[model samples]
Target: IQALPVSKTLQLDLLLGTTQRFVRTEPVRPLFKQLLEQVGAGLGEGQGLDAMAARLAAVEREQFQPFEDRHPFVWKNLLLNEFAYAMFPKGGAADIERELMGIVVKFALIKLYACGLMAHRGADFSLDDVVRVTYVLSRAITHNRRFLPNLLQTLQDHDALRLDVMTQFVL
Candidate 1:
């Protein structure tokens, strides 16, 4: 597989930020820490991103399977709720919503990429795969919401929509 254009520094920062955010959240913190430790232990030798992603997926599945079995859409609900919060963050300037939404989109893209990579392992995956996965995930996440109308309303409501942030998320 060809290397993605994302910088190692940016990847490290995203990983650290994600880890810290999850670790700070109560109830899930212990489980998140345990998953991280499990991933660390699984990365014993010359394993690469694929191995790490697979291990993380395995650990997450093992940990969440029972809950998932009981509440099939729990993960999707959690993700959508997070995205909704980003769209309308409290106690911050309204202008920050774009940045927060961009961050959420970035994390969502990373997840989609990881899932695609795992599913298409040894297949002829390409940048088109990324685009397709992004589209599909976006559709799935936004299916229940009137996302486009709300986004348009937000654009009309806010003076600045932060095209730079949107562009950053796109590219």
Candidate 2:
């Protein structure tokens, strides 16, 4: 995947709030860097989606636990913002958002799978599973907007009580 060339202004805007009140970007920068390092550690050149998924699934929760525990608010906010940006269009940044959404979805899926909530056939997890997990996670991440509600309902309609249970279980 090509790295999104984030402008300094946009980077600052993301780390610091757009509002009048001053927000610190210094602390957030290292966190972002650590996130990038964690995500990129296992990726290799010319790898397919299956390879990517396998690597991600193999990632231990401990790798992310410290970050999540230390900065829960910032972590959640970053994820929520990523989802919002990915779902909605930002002017002149459609490409960036698309790339970002892909990463966020993958990361979210990995986290879910690591928690043993998702089933897989080795490196190959089903697209249906992806949709189901993403839907559940997005809902948990933000109640303000529903992402792929129709698809989630369709999945639940077919899958019986599993998805409903997942919704209850995932935090």
Model 1 ranges off by over 4 Å: 1-4, 17-28, 42-79, 85-171
RMSD of 1: 13.2
Q: Candidate 1's error at 101, in angstroms?
A: 5.7
Please give the TM-score that candidate 1 achieves against the real structure.
Answer: 0.32
lDDT of 1 by residue, 20-107 (tens): 3434542232433443343344432135555655544553354324434555564465456656755655547865665565445544
Give residue 73's lDDT in candidate 2 (0 to 100).
69
Candidate 1 lDDT (Cα, whole model)?
Answer: 0.42
Candidate 2 per-residue lDDT over residues 1-171, each given as its tens digit: 124331222211221112111112222233333333333343321354445444433433333354346546644554576667566454456555444434343343335333232222323433444344445444433442233232233334545223233322222
Task: For candidate 1, give the lDDT of residue 63.
Answer: 35
lDDT, model 2: 0.36
Off by over 4 Å in 2: 1-50, 59-62, 73-147, 157-171
Q: What is the TM-score of each candidate against the true structure?
A: 0.32, 0.27
lDDT of each: 0.42, 0.36
lDDT of 2 at 152: 33
